[model samples]
Target: MKIVLASASLRRQELLKRIIQDFHIVVSNFSEDSIMYNNDPKDYVIKLSQGKAREVSERIDHEALIIGADTVVVLENKIMGKPKDEGDAFNMLKNLSGKWHKVYSGITLINTKDGKSISDYVCTKVKFSHISDEDIQKYINTGEPMDKAGAYGIQGLGGIFVEAINGCYYNVVGFPLNKISGMLKQMV
Candidate 1:
């Protein structure tokens, strides 16, 4: 059996490498906008994850296990995806400063051979330290938050802004190793 990851995120790929290195990175060009945010955060992420996995699975053989994942930061029940631009990122960081938010990652794996599929969600509570306007501006200027949800990447320079987190740290980084390992054990 071969393992394939369906995402372009280096962070996720790196996380997966820490557990299982026998994998290939095949980014799924699935447009993330198709998933509606009106549904529960977990459900929405799962839908996106499934869609991504299916997108990649279509071109692979039955023995390939394609893994796809989607993450979102939920604040007050509102889902926040990757920021649109610098201004949007600034606002997102501002909103997250000194506040607690939930990070939800939906992971899905599909084995096209048997049409086997599994979808699960991992949640982490993260709290950010109060950030000054200047600090936020500096962080935004660096352009590190542009491609990250909630305008921050806990594994990057943005980690400086996070004061604490409750739950799997790897989930916020991009992949939940424990969750992924548990699922893989069952499938294998």
Candidate 2:
């Protein structure tokens, strides 16, 4: 069977390579509006992932294993998505300093042939060390936090800010390899 990825994120692409190296990339045009859901984080993420996979599945011509994922950072029950600007990034970083937050990743797998699908969400608790304003500013200046949830990338320079994590590191990066692999096994 052919394999396809339904996301444009370089992080997801790179992480998925650890499992399937020959998959095709097909970005989904499903615009994510977290505000509309306002439900449980798990439900929100799963819906988003399924939406992406379904969107891509509709566009493909042949049977393929389509993978889609969505990730979000939650602080005090509020969902934090990609920052809008440098100021937004800075505020997010400031709020995250010296605190523990949750990272939720939802993965969905779709078989275009029979329309079979599986979706699950994983949550990771991450703690950030107290960082100075100057350091936050310096990190923000790199522009790394602009396009990342919670205004940080745990696998990049932002890793320095993380003091501890209670779950899969790959989940924080965007996808959960363990869950994805297990789901694929079930599909087979």
Candidate 3:
């Protein structure tokens, strides 16, 4: 059976690679801004992921297993997605400093052949150390947080600021390996 990924995120691609070495990437043409927020993080992410997978499924001319994922960082009920600019990144990092936040990753697996699919989400708690303004600037200068949700990546330089994590490390990285493994086991 053929496997396809319905996302353009390098992070998600890398995470998925750790599970299966062979797969094709089909960037979902789904417009993300079309999603409406309902204040439910898990539901929101699942919807977004499913939308991506569905979009890709419709575009593909052949049968394949398609995977879609979406991640967000939540702080005090506020959702922080990718930064709009360097200043936005700085503000997000500042808000995350010395705070415990939740990272939610929603994953959807679609079997286009029979239209069978499953969607789920994983949440991880991450705590950031008190970061100084100077350190934030230096980290921002590296341009790592620009494309990452919550203005930081636990797998990159942003890892240094993480003081504690209470759940799957990979979840903060944009995919939850343990949950995904179990979910895929039934599919294959």
Candidate 4:
């Protein structure tokens, strides 16, 4: 069966490529703004992922396995998504300075042929070293944090701020390769 990825994120695409070499990209029309965070970060991401997968599945006419994913950075129970502006990015960076945060990624797989679906999540704990205001400004100037959750990207220039991670590195990168691979194996 054909495999379809329901995301437009480059990070997710690159990670998926490591496991499935020939999957197709079908960016979902689902909007994250439509989902309300009910104070449960894990369930919120799972719902977002499921929404993306279901949206894409409805748009496809052929049999395929649709993979949908949503990732968020949570610090002190607060969900931090992409920053809206430079100031927002600065504040997020400041809040994350010298602290441990949780990265939660939700994955959903839908089998178009049978209408069966699987949804799961992975959480990774990431610690950031204390960052100076000047450094945060420099990093924000690079524009890497604007499109990333918690105003940072572990795989990009923002990597300098990350001191360590206690879970899947891929999960912090927003794909969770091992989890995705295992999920695919179970579905197939």
lDDT value, candidate 4, whole model:
0.96
lDDT for each residue of candidate 3 in 32-97, tens digit (9 for 90 to 100): 788888899999999999999999999999989998889999999889999999999999999999
**Lowest lDDT 10-residue stretch of candidate 3:** 179-188
Clashing pairs in 4: none
User: What are the lDDT figures for the candidates, one per model?
Assistant: 0.90, 0.92, 0.92, 0.96
Residues 1-188 of candidate 4: C-alpha lDDT, one tens digit per residue: 99999999888888899999999999999988999999999999999999999999999999999999999999999998899999999999999999999999999999999999999999999999999999999999999999999999899899999999999999999999999999999899
TM-scores for every candidate against the unseen true structure:
0.96, 0.97, 0.97, 0.99
Query: Which number leads on TM-score?
Result: 4
* Ranking of all candidate structures by their TM-score, best first: 4, 3, 2, 1
Best by lDDT: 4
Superposition TM-score, candidate 1 onto the true structure: 0.96
Please say which candidate is ahead in lDDT: 1 or 2: 2
lDDT for predicted candidate 1 compared with the true structure: 0.90
